[model samples]
Target: MDIIRTISKGTDLGGKDPDHIVELCNEVVQEGHSVLIFCSSRKGCESTARHISKFLKKFSVNPQNDDNEFSSIISALDALRRSPAGLDPILEETLPSGVAYHHAGLTVEEREVVETCYRKGLVRVLTATSTLAAGVNLPARRVIFRQPRIGRDFIDGTRYKQMAGRAGRTGIDSKGESILICRPEEIKRIVGLLNESCPPLNSCLSEDKNGMTHAILEVVAGGIVQTANDIHRYVRCTLLNSTKPFQDVVKSAQDSLRWLCHRKFLEWNEDTKLYSTSPLGRAAFGSSLSPDESLVILLQFFITLIIFEATAFNLVEILLLL
Candidate 1:
């Protein structure tokens, strides 16, 4: 990754300059190289892709310009048209120029088309959110960071390495290059991060993160843990248990189970002294909803039902108001 050359558009700028990013991408594409731009959010990806496409439109900078019929582009368009998402308006405008955005916000069909075209080297300039860093194997000759962040917070060494690693792939390119756009004041921090090793991995099931509740819910819903002893046994094998005292782990597990039961996600049998997932619990697990989220959904559902029964308003009207 290249970090020595810091381009300054003006003094006192807080973030990346779009003009510089566009110019840099244009130069890379004009040189017959594919580039990937990492954006912080889905909206950022879309906007950056559009900006690059517009800037490159003035000149014949597209690497794929030699294809008169744009056969690959046409095939991609056909696939999107036939899929449920149809042809996205932004994609319809940008894909012809070998540019597109990839993010979770796009439908499965849309993401498939973008991934297929980009992998085949049809789409030269691709913009995507940080999720793309680890989700797919589509590498590029050059990778550019619109900003040195995944969101408001600066990226850590591990994330930086993951995104930068995509710049060059074995048997794909002669060399790989990555560029991170940051303010002049951030150069030192960025350099330190580049030189530093990744931090040690840690468990996210702590009380503050609230992952334990979800974890306990999954096991119970899946019938993996049926009784209190089973719950304790499962907890004993967790990383959380290794880090915390056994009694503490047991207490947390009990709290999670109490919360789940109170939420109608679990039922206890006094006769057999066993625990089982309730219908609501199974529904929550199947939908992958967290405990708090499921509670909110359940409340909303009941409120909607009450509104439907107490008034003459149609379901659509009640939904719109809610």
Candidate 2:
């Protein structure tokens, strides 16, 4: 994936920005290549898509665009247009030229429709949030990142790799190209990132799992919460779980509890159906660790010992279970 750092107008001077973005996209897209642009938010995604679609439409004509491909795209959009309030004004105008935007704010059905068209090669240009970058396996000839930060958090190297990985379609694309439209200030960092290799995957279960585990322990230890219900209440206050139903949140907590018990970090009393942290659990808690992470570290250490002393395949069996 090619990471292109846009100069002058992109980030250093704010107002003249995005217009230059549209201009750049115009130059790339008109050459018959599709571009997937990742904006910072859902609103930015919508706005960017609309802006580019409008500019492209001056050269776009209905009922004829050289083939039947566009006709299929229009029909897909028309179905949305005819439903309820129909397509948004932005989508209604843009979809005619095989362009659209995607983000989490839209309904599942709405997202499915847009994604289907893009996959069918009916949608040529797409503006989307980083959600699209991580959630699906959609590839485009070119990827243009309009911003480095999404909301308050900067996109990290792992995420950059994940998003850029969407660039080339296997067999279909000779090679995928990705562009990072950043200010001159961000150029060095972005270039340094390009030279680095990706580290091993850490299954960060929804934004700082280890941190959340420690926070939850703090809440419990501080006497702020005495029951699973209280734990669920606080967890629901978090951004990741805020929109999730309380029942779902509680179920997840319960699963974590069971996992802790299985890890020998917590004791579950069958007769009373009560749960309490064991010595290991308390030790892990004091050190700011989740039972799962602690188990992983312990396993790694044990494997090292076994590599020098043990003759049994116990480590292999344990790894298989994990």
Candidate 3:
């Protein structure tokens, strides 16, 4: 997706001025096209939507036709009122002007109403958090980023592409455009992001993320791995091994195995140099529990069992002493 770059004299936090954003939406809506504005936070989404809605209402832009027998905007408003969240005050103000914001902070019912309205063209301008880009199919003629960052950190290439992809729906719009509102100091960074390639794929089983512990436990418990040699062989074939140094991969695997043994999740025979899953490990593997999860569950179970035994046997005094 191609981005039409724009610079802004922004706030201290580096986001574009909300008034400028409202005017941009005004221009897009006047041309009879929908616009999607991506904001960094849920609060930002609501604030930006309020700004655009007020502007649209003041100028009577994109107003719903009068005397419609069944107006979707009215229907959406009714739906929100009946919902558990009871017509979000922001939505109550904005939906009448064909504007709304979407984010996780809204109840499921609220988000559904906003999404349906936008899709049916009842809502002309939508402001939303970055999650809307990744999770929803709502597209627009023009996509605008209120800020380059989703939160405090700058958005990466993949996320930018995801949000930008929402522009220019396949059959509806003949052309799609993406605009990034950045401060002067951020121009170089934004340009680099526009040119950056997607980051390389990494294994979910990488030790750095603690996935190695789960992987090693599963293999050994399932009898797929028998010894340290078998672990080294297994490690050599994984995606983690491909990206990391051979020695590092083996060391990580060995460390995970040792950890499992130390936690009594696995047993190792010094003479045979073989590894086997303990009863706890077998139970954990069978239940599809992670090593840490299994430990917590076991501890909780034993605590409950001890309490029950003490109470049933009338040994509360002895229990306390021990």
- TM-scores, one per candidate: 0.59, 0.55, 0.61
**What lDDT tens digits, residue by residue, belong to model 2 across residues 94-195?**
787668999887776677788898887667789889888766877887888888877667777878888887878787787788777777788888777767
Model 3, 158-213: lDDT tens digits are: 99998998888789888888988888799989989999998878898775579999
Query: What do the candidate models score in CA lDDT, each in turn?
Result: 0.83, 0.70, 0.83
Regions more than 4 Å wrong, model 1 = 1-34, 40-44, 51-70, 131-141, 149-159, 168-176, 192-200, 206-208, 216-279, 303-322
Least lDDT summed over 10 consecutive residues: which range in candidate 3?
A: 10-19
Q: TM-score of the candidate numbered 3? A: 0.61
Q: Rank the candidates by TM-score, best first.
A: 3, 1, 2
- Please provide, for model 1 over 39-61, each residue's C-alpha lDDT reduced to its tens digit, 9 standing for 90 to 100: 88888999888777775633234
Which RMSD values do the candidates have, in order?
Answer: 8.3, 19.7, 9.5
